[model samples]
Target: MSSAPTPSRSVIHGDALEWLAAHPGTPGASLLTSLPDKAELGLPIERWRPFFQQAASLCLQAVDEEGLCVFFQTDNREQGRWVSKAGLVLAAAAELGVPLLWHKIVLRRPAGSRSMGRPGYSHLLAFSARATVPAEASSPDVLPELGELPWSHGMGLAAAEESLRTIRRASPSTRLLLAPFCGHGTALEVANRHGLDALGIERNRKRAERARGDR
Candidate 1:
């Protein structure tokens, strides 16, 4: 059997957007990240569009022509309105002229108890500076979402791992992975698990430390 990918070995404590702006990334690097949910930021959804646009722009600036960006996001509904974080990111990518390669659904089964209109799914969006190459194992358009692992409220480890695998399968030439809003480093940990070089930036010091602990 093939050996497992290398471990995620680095973590940075800072804001992802700022970090991206301060330190440029090499070409062919892949970005795997999940921005803070709309509710978590305590900001109105109306204010999120510009923020995501600037964030995407900074990330695009860091990568090369062949770089790929994989975004993991879920719905955030408040007061009966579902806020589409993925949509905003997509718009941001389009604004930057990045071609949207593919988008996949991650289906989740409700645990504990069910509520009215609560969704049991998330989205994984992939974009590239240019066209992307598909992999045989990465052809699935929808994947089963993984269970949460002691998560304080972020992307699931299993889900993140599978998404990273898919991204790598599509772009095997990508050498490094960047996560600007790494939150708790789920993406970074998954990157390391795949033995890919990765860097994660989180503004929350505690979350950043916890991300390292996940390793």
Candidate 2:
């Protein structure tokens, strides 16, 4: 951890897999990321399984025994059937010895505003190298604060912030929040706003510049 290169706000512009391979951290550091969906990326559904499988392995390797990962994903309609992308991640994590600690629903859809053929909610799944404590004593499994949000690459800022709060409660000593697929630094902004150190990695130069508040 001490040997890992640090960037401003700990955010670096590079591949997350490559970064994680070199800078694994201890239990006090956690990852809160809203990954790009296969639909959003224009990738086939079949490709996501292996991709997330590899990602889960990398994430589990990067964190310590108690370090947790909060993955934000939404269910989508694929060729007339509903598919849970989070489910794929769950299986991937399980294969790598990480267990699902909690599954939170971000109720982003308001009454009558639901999109046709899509679920009305998104999921925030928390995982840890070790078994995660039950979330019943802390935050509820359904988050109602996500009624409205600023959207970027299909993720909302307020929603991401609220989700991070849940993870913080679970990992109170966590000092840094890392977003591997940071599109416009939404998670990074939210983490910094809460007085936590945040790191973002984006391969897109334009979005990365926007995240840094540069013109």
Candidate 3:
């Protein structure tokens, strides 16, 4: 019986935007990340929107042309209005001339359930500058539920798995996963388990250390 190859993980403690700008278009790298919400950044909605757009643009730009950039985001209600992170990401991708490869909805709560602040579903969107997914290679458009979350704002295990599966199919040459704003290393851990090297950039020192998974 053959064994799976061990993967490597490198967690950097610094601003994601700075890192992305400094290392754009990384070869053999794809992205799977969840951008931080306004609350986490301690910024007003007005300020956070631009920040989110810029972060999304950088993420899309950081990957190789043949690589995919996936985002896991949930919609939230702010000041009696719905704020859609998916919409924001779509706009960013549009500006960059990237095409949407797929958009899957992952249930945060059971179907037909109601929520107060965030919706009952989260968006799993993939974009690529040149990669294309054929109709025969399509996966589920909607996920039944988010498997397990490592933190309150981390990517779910099932979602991460699905994203990586899509990447494996769409971009077979992808050897690394880049995660910016990695909360608790949920995606990083999942990436390693899937035999892909993972690199994460986080602004919070404590969270960055935790993302390293050394202890």
Candidate 4:
């Protein structure tokens, strides 16, 4: 039998907290929402409280010992901070060692917007994390994506893959789809051509202009 080295973990997370807090109450995530499982290290998920108690608690201890969660979502701490609009919660947990469950979500505006443009979208790769578990949280059947983008690189990509890897082993029937149909031109065509069953959503029209970056 061959044994391979274990992969490093990360989470590619967006500042869901910043985006959601921008709005008082938005139904998109407000109605029947809960914490999600299967969070990757590079890309932080929507900060589902109580649901991620185990990981969140561990994250708090790591932050307390290391001065920060080391979210691993991005190299640019500033950009990641923008996504982790609720950094204070994580910071508090680190300081007190008492985890605090978060509001479950903090959404940002769509990509390519400045200062909560749509009040529900953002381009920053920030994080929305919690320290404790929530009573309303539930486990997700499928792994969630960070920034919900089409790129296969960066902290988010690393994070997503890590989560998917674990999930595949735990439940082989569940599959992870990347960059599901988000780009124009040969990108989507390529996904179809390869029979890889690309998984991503691209509602933004400007994505068409990003043909050069498509792989």
Best by TM-score: 3
Estimate, for each residue in 46-136, the C-alpha lDDT of model 2 and write its tens digit.
8865676676567666765666787878777878888877777787787776777778888766645757666777888888766356546
Candidate 2 — which pairs collide?
A: none
- What C-alpha lDDT values do all the predictions have? 0.73, 0.71, 0.93, 0.29
lDDT of 4: 0.29
> TM-score rank, highest first?
3, 1, 2, 4
Task: Give the backbone clash total of model 4.
Answer: 33
> Which RMSD does model 3 reach against the true structure?
1.6
Q: Rank order by lDDT, top first? A: 3, 1, 2, 4
Best by lDDT: 3
lDDT of 2: 0.71
Model 2: what TM-score?
0.82
| Candidate 2 deviation (Cα RMSD) | 4.6
Report the error of model 1 at residue 6, Å: 5.9
TM-score, each model?
Answer: 0.83, 0.82, 0.96, 0.24
Worst 10 residues of 1 by lDDT: 110-119
